[model samples]
Target: MLITQCQQADVALLEEHLPSPSRTSFHAQRFARQGVGTSTYLVAWLADRPVANAEIRWNGCAATEVRQAVPNCPEINGLSVTEPLRGGGIGTALIRHAERLAVERGVQRIGLGVDDDGNPRAAALYARLGYRPVVRYLDRWSYTAHDGEVHDIEDPCVFLAKELTSAPTPDLGVRVQ
Candidate 1:
């Protein structure tokens, strides 16, 4: 599996596979317009087939709970792994990728919101990844569905955060005399 930033070619490929009205397409376009270090779109591929995706937003995000809790921290949003590829560590890789990007930008902390009521497994995963809950609230947002119908979402959510620190350099095990 390979994880990389979405390129122009990747955008076209995402549009073809994911299409608009899906969050994937929306994030891909945002990445194209905003570029890296601001809003980055990442795609996880398995031998050329896109298997998962996530976005790191430096400017801000729609999750009011997370924004209010960590105003200056970058947020990871829209993390999704294809149905058949779930539980294969793709989501973990995407998250780590976002964290690495945040560290590169000198960001000290990162935040994300999970639907606690709807997806307990995801919440568990975040906890296992060292994210601690900071806030709880209802997530309300509106989006146009695939059939061109507007939909309103109001899910109970928990905001989780983790501090980003540089990894310790590996020791070569050489003792100097």
Candidate 2:
């Protein structure tokens, strides 16, 4: 197994191997482009094929809104391992790789979200990796619903995070949950 920063040439390979959410070409391009200039993504391969992937972002997106609401937080983006290889530690490898990159980039902490019931396994995996849940929210219609009316769903999505390196000047905005 080899872990390396993703390249444009590796995009199609990643698309062919990862599952639905991680397979799109646009994201592959984004990751390859950003990982190069920005150092935000890392891809894991086995036998020369993409098997797992993760992204560590300086900011949070919708999944990380709760943490953003809190204060200071470093947001982590997509983290996934191909379904067929789930129990084999690919996810852990990808996360650890992201951690190394995050630490190198001077980030003090990192955050990510686990989808409601839909991704329970991912939540458990993150917990095993020392991530703690700091916030929870309901997921209404997901990409198309109002926050006010979205409050009733029992979706229970969770935001989890881990402190990477403590900064000399504490950014007391938020602590990873």
Clash totals in order: 0, 5
Model 2 C-alpha lDDT per residue in residues 1-177, reported as the tens digit of each score: 677766778777876776333223544655754765643666777777877777765655444457555455655666777778888877776676667667767777777778867887888888887789878865343221332332233456777878875432222221111
What's each prediction's TM-score? 0.83, 0.71
Q: Model 2: which ten-residue window has the lowest total lDDT?
A: 168-177
Badly placed stretches (over 4 Å) of model 2 are 19-26, 32-39, 70-72, 138-156, 166-177
Off by over 4 Å in 1: 19-24, 168-177
In angstroms, the error of model 1 at 160 is 0.3
RMSD (CA, Å), candidate 1 to true, equals 5.9
What TM-score quantifies how close candidate 1 is to the native fold? 0.83
> Which predicted model would earn the best TM-score?
1
Structure candidate 1, residue pairs in collision: none
